[model samples]
Target chain A: MLKYFEQLGHKLIEWITIAREFIRLFFETVFWLIVGPFKDKPVNFKSLFFQMVFMGVNSIIIVFFVTFFTGVVLAMQAAPQLDKMGAVIYVSSLVSISICRELGPVLTALVIAGRIGAAITAEIGSMKVNEQIEALETMAISPVRYLVAPKFLALVIMLPCLTIIGDASGIFGGYVVGTTSLKINAGLYLQTTWKFLSRKDIYTGLSKSVVFAMIIALVGAYQGLKTKGGAVGVGRATTISVVTSFILIIIADCILTGIYFFSDM
Target chain B: MPEKEIAISIQNLTKILGGRKVLDNVSFDIYRGEIFVIMGGSGHGKSTLLRNMTGALIPDSGKILFNGQDLLKLSVAERERVQRRFGMSFQSSALLDFLNVEENVSLPLVEHTKLSPKVIDIISKMKLSLVGLQGFEKYYPSELSGGMRKRAGLARAIAMDPEVVFYDEPTAGLDPVVCAVVDQLILDLTRKLKLTSIVVTHNMESVFRIADRIAMVFKGKVEQIGTREEIRNSKNPIVQQFIKGELEGPIQIT
Candidate 1:
């Protein structure tokens, strides 16, 4: 019993230290993003552009497909129940509102957390192991400023954009199911989606996506920068980064959803 | 000889890593424009000491004075100002594999200078040429052989025309011919640039070939510090055993 408590205490301290480091990295990254340009030490725009392309553009197809299928499944599941109430057309509103308020942002964030998050961890972890990061320090370069900030900035900008695309594609999927499978008119389906999806729902989902982006980028970068050993270490960090990002994204989505639901905003 | 000018002074440097004293009470002065080699067997803190001197690793307790300025006491901005005059070559070469040779060499210049892209390009080319790597500027690091990668790393290290260059096991995984070539490049660059070179290596041949002075560290402590001739004729058993590459010695391999 004593040994168990000791182990638990050690684990708690370790987590606290890790949390502190993670917060520090986030602030340092933000500092570089905000202060670097005035100091004539701007985060490299070229690198930032590349990260945007990789994280946002390359991810579009995957996000679209994932959310589209989800919308289809959602519509198919909702139509049968709503038909008993003589309101099968409500399936359009159900799919669009859910996609805008919940599914689109959550699914898009999870996918990016899998893709970009893993890549960030692997890239930074390998750099850490290979002494490239130390080489940067030797040259008076902050890896956080040069490396992490651009990634953070790019993800912050791109995730919301991807969520928007995911939302549209998901609504299109719901339209397809409602029009063809359920024999609802296409115009009525579109009208129902537009009517149900309010500005609050759209903005709330975008806001959730923004928070998820920070979580993914920070967790990935933190795991990466602290990576030890070598190739195995990078692999381990990548896995942990993705897993942590996934868990955090879901938890954050739950909390944000609760806040939006109860706060009456 | 005129009194040697001290470039960097390490005073009672100590570092602890993973509950072990990786460097303990390490003190030395590297004179200006000299090749000071820190040599010891594998896992003996030679690299750790080099990292400390290069400002890559912070010592737990000690002062590293570069040109009479204590590096540890400086603010980040001030430390960075001091650090810009320093460069390091890694054992693994540590070239940004994503970048081509030209871009890799130009990294420090791009980060630290207000020079235009064209000027940075020319300067990076000049540095690569100095290391005999001019023609390979377009090639990525993965496309280069081990020897070429090391040379490119050397080019990048000297790209800023730094006041001090720290090399960690420059010839660790190289063939003899390549090792000689690297040693010759180190000598040439140090002589031509008048830069203080601090090399950490256990290779006896490379050490003797290039060292103006040598420091042998053992178990996180300095065992001996002397000129190559003085080290060759030293009375220390650990020094003799290490230099001679002998199995029978105070250094027991477990």
Candidate 2:
């Protein structure tokens, strides 16, 4: 029993250490960004813009197409249940609320985490292993300011943009299902979507997106920066970065959503 | 014997990594305008010592005095001011893979100075020429040969006209001709630029060719340090075994 308690205590300490380090990294990245323009920034913004494009514009088609398909699935599932209650007309409201409030930001964040998070971790981890980070330091450069800050800023901007696109595509998907398949009045569908979905839903989704963006970039960069060993270590960091970002995005979504849910109640 | 001015004075430096004493009570002084080589067997803390000297790794205890001022006690901005006097070339070259050669060389110049692009370009070209890599300006690091990559790394290191340049295993993974070329470059840079060179390597031939003085690290301590001729004539059997590469002696081949 003593051994069991000791092991549990050790595990708890381990997690706390990880969390503490992550929070420190988060603030350092934020501090660099807040003072970025005033500092002697040798940041490669051209590369950052390209990465932002990769994170935002490149993911557009796939994100929209995937969310469009999901909207169709949501409508299909909802039509039967609402129809049995003689309320098939509410499907447009149901789909719009679900996509804007829940699916849009959450799904976009998950996909971006899987795609770009792995890349950030691998790139930074490779640099860390190669002594490039130390080289930068010896050059009087802050790796956080030079590397992580640009990534954080770019992703924070891009994820919200991608989330908005996901929102539009999903709503359009619902439109198609409700009008052509369900034979609901097109005008009525539009009215219901607009009526049920307020600016708050859209704003909150984008806010969630911004929060998710910070999580993914910071988590990925943190894992990458802490990487030791060589090739195998870099590969492991990439995997952990993706997994951690995914889990954190979900947890953040739930906590934010719960706060809003309760306040609205 | 004429006394030389100390460029860097290291005092009883000790560093522990993962509970292992990689650097233990090591002390030495590298004179100005001299190529000081730290040589040892693998896993023997030679590179660790170099890292400590370059301020990349802070020792658990001890002082690194650059021209008599303690490097470890300075504020962040002040330390960076002190650090700007250093340039470190890694074993792998560690060039930013995304950047072209000229861009990589121009990095420090652009970061630390307000010089115009035309001037930065000219200086970068000059440094590259010094390293014998003049025409390869547009090529990325990947397009260069292993030796060319090392040259470019050296070019970048000296970009800021730093007082001290640290080279970690400069001739590793290169042909003998290329090794000789790198050695010649180190000698030329030390003479022409008057920059202090602290090199860490196990390549004994390179050491003898380039070192003005040598420090042999054994078991995390500076077991022996002397001029090349003195080290050659020393009666230390372990040092002799290392320089001779004999499997018959004290060092256990792991």
Candidate 3:
């Protein structure tokens, strides 16, 4: 038993050492990638464009559909409850505030975490397994600069864009639910939603989306970059990146919401 | 040969994994424009030694000097800069299945050079043709046969026109005919391009065909370093056993 414990301890230490080296490589790559664009070498606009298309354009449809469904479900659930309290007219206000302030950004991030996060992880992991990462290193190109930096920048830029679209689509969904299903006046619904929504709410949602984007991008890239073994390792990293990003986004949403609500109270 | 132009000088190198020594105080030097081969049986640390020379793995002790500068002492960036002078072909080919022959061959140029895509495309096509893979440029790795994939990998390795190229078991998984083609390619590249090549292989035929000098690694240390004739004439019992493929040797298979 003691021998087995010792073996386990030794393995743990080895894993930790590898993890430390991975972290160091990741940060070092990030530093060089940040500086690479300004160096003597010209920036690669083609790579940047590819990243924008992958991180932004490819993800829009999923974001739009998910946000729309979330809005519809929230309105449908809230309508009866609001009617019970004789506050049926304020259903739009509740839906808009919840969806815009929290649901829209968090749900959209979750969708992207599932879609784009997995892709980044799988792509980088495949590069690692195939030794293309090693090839890049051999060519005096920082793999992080050539690979991870563009991904990071793309996600950071596009997450907010997706969030804005999600916010609008979600509101539109609530309008559909209220005016069609609940027979509420469309003009009154819009007015109530406008009255309740604030600049702080929008800004807060966008800020959370930004934070979630960073986490998803960083964690996904980190996991992918650290992948070893081969095909099996890449697959495992992709799965782990999606699952971890989803859990972290939810946890972050709770904490942010707690702070936002309690501070106001 | 001038001492200043030594491509690689490894001294007193040691590597330990799981407290077992993988390479023990191994030392060797590779001169410019020479085909140096490291030969050993399976699990004899030949690949480990190659990886150490390439700075893919750092030694627990000793130095790897590339062009007189200690490769291990350099930062990752600096090490990578040194690595640019070398290219490697992995045993498994390691081709990107998603990328076609042209894109795969152009990877190094795309990553490290500011050359326009048109120029890169032309250079990529040239490399493919040089490897006798001209019309197959649009085919992905999965679409190619085993031999063609290896040729494509070689094209990629030489795309940057590296001074030194490393081949890890280039003939391992190929038919005899394909192996001959690969061996001929290695010879042609060395002679035509004046490139220093280090090949690790257990294939005795490959070693005899391409190696200007051969180093035999055994149990984490170099057991012999000599020309093919010198090695064949060696009186060392282990060398005799290995070269003759005798099972009754001092090298106990574990």
Q: Identify the candidate with maximal lDDT.
A: 1
Clashing residue pairs for model 3: none
Better TM-score candidate (1, 3): 1
**Candidate 3 segments whose C-alpha is farther than 4 A from its true place:** A1-33, A41-43, A258-265, B1-5, B75-77, B96-99, B114-122, B241-248
DockQ of each: 0.87, 0.83, 0.46
The sequence of per-residue lDDT tens digits that candidate 3 reaches over residues B1-254 is 45536788989999997788999999989988889999988887999898887767778999988888998888877777778778888786777665788888998888778899999999999988888999998898988898998899999889998889999889988999899999999999988898999999998888888899999999999999998899889988888888788999898996
- Indicate the TM-score of model 1: 0.98
Q: In candidate 1, how many Å is residue A246 off?
A: 0.7
Give the total clashing residue pairs for model 3: 0
Model 1 Cα lDDT, one tens digit per residue, B111-214:
88999999999999999999998789899999999999999999999998899999999999999999999999999999999999999998999999999999
State the lDDT of candidate 3 residue by residue for A1-265, as single tens digits.
Answer: 9999999999999989866865675575567556775774433567667888988898888889999988899888988898998898887988899888999999999999998899989998988887777656655666677677777777888999999999999999989999998888888889999998999899999999998987788778888987898889999999988998999899998899888777789
Residue A85, candidate 1: how far off, in angstroms?
A: 1.1
Per-residue CA lDDT of model 2 for A151-253, tens digit only, reads 8888999999999999999989988999998999999999999998988898999999999999999999999999999999999999999999999999999
Docking class of 3: acceptable
Local lDDT at A58 for model 1: 98
Q: By descending lDDT, how would the candidates be arranged?
A: 1, 2, 3
Model 2: which docking level applies?
A: high
Chain A only, candidate 1, TM-score: 0.98
Candidate 1 error regions (>4 Å): none
List model 1 lDDT by residue over A1-265, tens digit each.
9999999999999999999999999899999999999999897889999999999999999999999999999999999999999999999999999999999999999999999999999999999999998888888889999899999999999999999999999998988899998999988888888887789999999999999999999999999999999999999999999999999999999999999987775
